[model samples]
Target: MSQNTFDGVRTAIIANKVDGIVREMTNTLLRSARSAVINSARDFSCAILTDDDQLLTAAEGIPVHVFGAQLQAQALRAAHPDMREGDAYLDNNPYVGNSHAADHTILVPVFVDGEHLFTAVTKAHQADVGNSIPTTYHAAAKDVYEEGAVIFPTVKVQTNYENVDDVIRMCRTRIRVPSQWYGDFLAELGAARVAERRLKELVAKYGVETIRQFVTDWLDYSETVMAKAIESLPAATLRNTGRHDAFDPFLPDGLDFGVRIDIKPDQGRIDVDLTENGPNVDCGLNLTEATTRAAVFGGVFNAIPARVPKNSGAFRRVVVEMNEGSAVGKPKFPHSCSVATTNVTDRLINCVGAAFAQLGEPYGVAEGAVGVGAGYAVLSGRDRRTDEDFVNQLCITANGGPGSAYADGWVTYGVPCVSGLMYRDSVEIDEIKMPIRYKHLRMVPDTSGAGKYRGAPSFEFAYTPTADPISVIYPCDGQIAPSKGVAGGEDGARAAAWLEDADGTRSQLPNTVAMVLQSGQTVHGFDASGGGYGPPLQRDPRLVLEDVLEGWETAEHATATYGVEFIDTPDGLAVDDAATERRRS
Candidate 1:
């Protein structure tokens, strides 16, 4: 075979092997993980990196984990100058290079033929990391110390496959669920071992030098491709701003979150500066450095072409700057940043995408779900039936708004920042885990952003407390403020929630989780919709009629909101072309 043929074969084999390694890693973690977050929701990521710490490939997991680990890898090498073959490090400190303290990362260096080849890393999000509150993301806290747990960099947890009892004991003691924590840690180790064996096999088949060279070449090629893509984009600086409700317990006054992006075409780089953001609060909305980086990368990647391979190479041309004490960027230590990942990070990405839209037409996707939608229900007090330690369960529901697109209206159930991601947990599962019953769950009709291409509709879910008295927490934004539209498209509808009782009494709901519900009371949640793109009047009459018949748009809505007339025919809905043309004129 020719040299080119040999290189092609080797690359193909390595790619397949790397892909298999990640699949096995996620499968192993899912099978063995103790918590629902890991096993059921699959809130974890696995990746293979070169020995020098360049990310090669990662399975479809959390965006933050994928990019955050790349930063962590570089930080690890810098922090641990004397990293050996048998040494494994465990880290979760956001300051060092992580999204937050709760996101524990386990990394082990892979060696073959007495030579360091790559590193296998598994990053998992734990429900609780021994925070001040039951959930690691406490919205009421002020500083990082109040947030929950913090693990520093270069914490050696394993040596030559031996269990580090000290580290294990410390983690087990700190977290609420020790059994789950231990199980996740073991699964991470198992994943690393699996990668190690596969990597060694590749080294045995192909020479170690050849494998190393391939890694270098692959990363270099990826970087070149990313840089070239950046160069192709129009040169311009775009600015956008977004906001989130302040959740500071000490400071009840609301605050604003902002972002500004500067794109440099000549240098083929995108620089994101968050220095003009809101002041730091004692709330959990504050972000750490690692979380900020992850959010920025997520926004950039989402706006760019999806064919681009995600790796450290892709981020090589991007530079992000944030104030050390700002709400959107890095925050001072000991600040509660539990909600940063869900709330602040999300807004950051939206703001960046909004900025990108100004550069040209069809630049980025519109905003989707903005808030964390954390509905925490804690059951205390003694149970009349069992009389055991009345179990208190805290759960979060996935509520998403529609996202706007260039050609079509916003996508319903579309995830922003991270595409193709969904939060899973049905009412049946919630009932089995806790004492709750869902009364009504369905999509909210006519609650989408109205435009030529209409935004996707939002969803609504109503649940009643069945077993014991429970506290319901709802953290959301875009209620008073609607998602902004680009071009001439209209903005999305404002979000709202309420509590309805069987006694025909209804009360407004707060964004916080302080309200307690009785056994018969029901809580209702309404998710917001995404902003629309382009002018509503420009919408096709035929498409408007189709939407009316499909129930996405009512006949009245088509006439009023979209300025398109529709007639109900015997066969189906038909567009009134004369009326539509007159309305447009």
Candidate 2:
């Protein structure tokens, strides 16, 4: 297969056909997965990778999981030269290519006749990954031994579409929830198989040579699109630093991350230097190779136009430099990357976006909310209905998105990693599955960062357990350092968590928590809002009045923060022209 051979129309048709196959894989996983986090929250990703290290998600991929997909594919092929049809492999070793041990990924080789063409990948976050503490994000774990999740390094799980009983038995014996694990495993396998079947069908319809040409043409096209986008930018070099809150007794002063970007418009390349970041600590917050690579590119892709295809061709435009054993670089083996998917990864991404803001107007967004709080905490307990054990993370609450150049931040924007892709779990499903009851979930007033186009407001969530007790674990951050605004915007509120007793006594909890919740006690969490984009004084008065009317902002906040005076009319709060003018001046 060579370049400039296939017609554009034929390339598009074949590309759509292949992408549709990937969608089928996504649907299979979503519908068949067993865990609440998977079937309900949609904490999984499906993608197809070329045998030659190019990743093709079309648009169906998670930033964290699929960013360094080539690494996993490389490891898979290197480990097994005997790869063939009807065979499957599992790789969850962060030390290898996986983002973290909690994500159980299934890889199946898509074979056309006897030639292996594509690999179907389905990565899903498990309810429990056999960790020592039951929770997946073991921020306290000093190393891999303390993390305790079984590390599978590209092990063959199936041959000729038949299960390896020994491997299955090993997982069943080690994991906490055997039946649930098996179900999720089957769901991932089913997704890969579905992709394999669909891909094979596509190849047969178009022939292998035609499909190969499409791959080549698509990659070239994507590269040209990204190159053109980069060439349009005014060349500039920017340096920025982002910080993570202290780990209390361990890192009292916290960690600082330094990022330098050299935008080369002539060469159509953006060079990101992460060599100046802090060294890796003993905690689980250290990043694996997969996550470290993904976080940087994810941010670069985000700062650019949405039309640029996020394939390997586009990825080649950005050159990344990482120092060995650095905190945001490559981690040595045995370092606990349990919380690799988020934590520092989120900050690194925000740093890249914020750095691009130096290029001036409409280039980048303000730093969005960072870290996972109690709202997305991992919960484990006995289900009274089924008389069985249960452990799953909730996805009911999310951090607000940062304000952009054109519009206000999205209210339901999740953590920077997910980018509003994950599904918000149904309260009814939570109540039915686990012995838990929801108290309330709502947005707090006057909590969003104020600017011309304001950021989204902070949200609060509260819940209680019906059982005697349930273990709750969360690696909460973003308390001391709130999401900072760019282009003269304001900062959002800090995150906070509290436990209210049956007698209505409330006690503040730390950012990082691993506690057991009593039956009557309720847990409440208020996540921070995102940063604003421009000066609030420049904001439209009508938008400020709308916020006051909607209760997302109060009249006092509008007058003080946004400098918009509101007068109560029979209809609602309307902007007062004279008072607003005076307030603004």
Candidate 3:
């Protein structure tokens, strides 16, 4: 192959092939994993990295999980310089480049003809990480010691294509539900190995020389594409600030946040600066290096066109600056980042995405609902039905997504961190797997942020334990400052979770909740709705009428919020066009 040869067609084909490889890995892991979080909720990611530890491909992977994979791959190389053909590493150390402890990552380096070529990667959030509480999101943990989850800093878990028995034995000893964890572990490792085998096949089909050349050219082409996307936008240097609801005793007034985004349109560069931030407190709300970087990238990528490849090639143009000691910037040593993947991370994403509104119309998104609500609770106990211990992070109802200039919010949006990629599990599966029964799950009316592009409405869920007592824990957010609309839209509602005992005694739960529900007790929760995108008055009368017919809003609500009137005709309710126009004026 000539160095001058640049076949765009071949490059495209190879790109598709590599992307398919990643998707295959994802499908395998999801289908084979034993944990509900992996198989049902799909809280996992897969990717392929270059020999030099640069992110090569992460097609359709969750934004937060895959964006910072290169950093962990780099750490693996640093820890194990003497790399071999048949070895895999596990990384979950926040300080050493991970989003948090619960996201156990497996890395397998691909080799061909005595040369290192690529690495297959898979990252999955564990259902139970051996924390002080049943939940992995330990929002109140004061430090790493209090968090009480094992941490791996790019440690070897496999060698010579065999499981390291010591590492497996240790994990089985510590984690609750040893068999369940081991099964998931095998599935995740198998996914990576599948990618490794696929890479070798590609090498055999296409000569090594041509494949290597494709990597170089493909990366360069990806850079140009991203550069062009940024060039299409207006240059800006914008600053935005937001606050998290106070967690009593530690942050009474709550934690305040600030972000600066500088866009050099001509140069095709964007700089996200988080140096001017508050110091890390003792709680698990502090951001790890991985979460800080991923949050910024997630917000920026959402701001730009979705076509921009989320790989190291395109990432070269964007610069992220973080302070070591700041809560939202990077991890402070020994400070708990147990809840790093969510909580404050969600708020920062909203602030950064909303900052783009400074560029004016159609440039920014309204704030989305933040937090892993009670609907996504961590439930645990011995399953009386099966006489075995069980634990799972149920993905029942997702938080509402923010409305955009082009579309309304996604109804099943899990959280801002997930980018709405994780699926909400089926209710039937929950009943089959755990000893619990859902009472009622319905959408809350009059909770959406009314606008031309209306936000997603809040959802309320009610459930009761059927057999034995169950521990329920959730680290929720967005109660204090419910998602606020941008571009003159109305603000959305707040979230709440509470328990009703058998005797009808009610208790309002705090933001970070951990309690037990007796067999007769019920858990009721409502996740906040997302913010609207544009002025409510600008909404079309026809859409408003449809909303009334669908019972998403009453005719009176439509009149009050959208200035649309309705009449009871012989056949059905119809929009009173004349009255609507008169009321608008």
Best by TM-score: 2
Q: Give model 1 RMSD, 1 decimal.
A: 3.4
User: lDDT by residue for model 2 over 336-404, one digit each (tens)?
Assistant: 899999989988888898788778777878878886989888999888788899888898897888887
lDDT of each residue in 1-585, candidate 3, tens digit only: 234788889999999999999999999999999998899889999999999988889998987888889999999999998888899998899887889999999999999987889999999999988888888888788999899999989889999999999998999999998898999899999999999999999999998998998888788777888888888889989999878888776566788989999999899888989989988988888988888888888888766754877888888888999899889987877999988888788888888888886676777888888867788889999898899988999888867788777787887777889978998887888888888999999888778888888888889998999979999988888888888788877777788988888898888878877888889999988988888888898888998888777767778788999999888899898888899999888
What TM-score would candidate 2 get against the native?
0.98
RMSD of each: 3.4, 1.5, 1.8
Give the poorly placed runs of model 1, Cα more than 4 Å off.
1-13, 84-87, 150-154, 248-253, 374-417, 501-504
Please provide, for model 1 over 64-100, each residue's C-alpha lDDT reduced to its tens digit, 9 standing for 90 to 100.
6777676788888888767767778898877766777
lDDT at residue 564 of model 1 (Cα atoms): 82
lDDT of each: 0.69, 0.86, 0.87
Q: What is the lDDT of residue 382 in candidate 1?
A: 36
- Candidate 1, residue 84: CA error in Å? 4.3
Can you list the residue pairs that collide in candidate 3? none
> Model 3, which residues run further than 4 Å from truth?
1-5, 569-571
Error of 3 at 357 (Å): 1.6
Better of 2 and 3 by TM-score: 2
Candidate 1 has an lDDT of 0.69
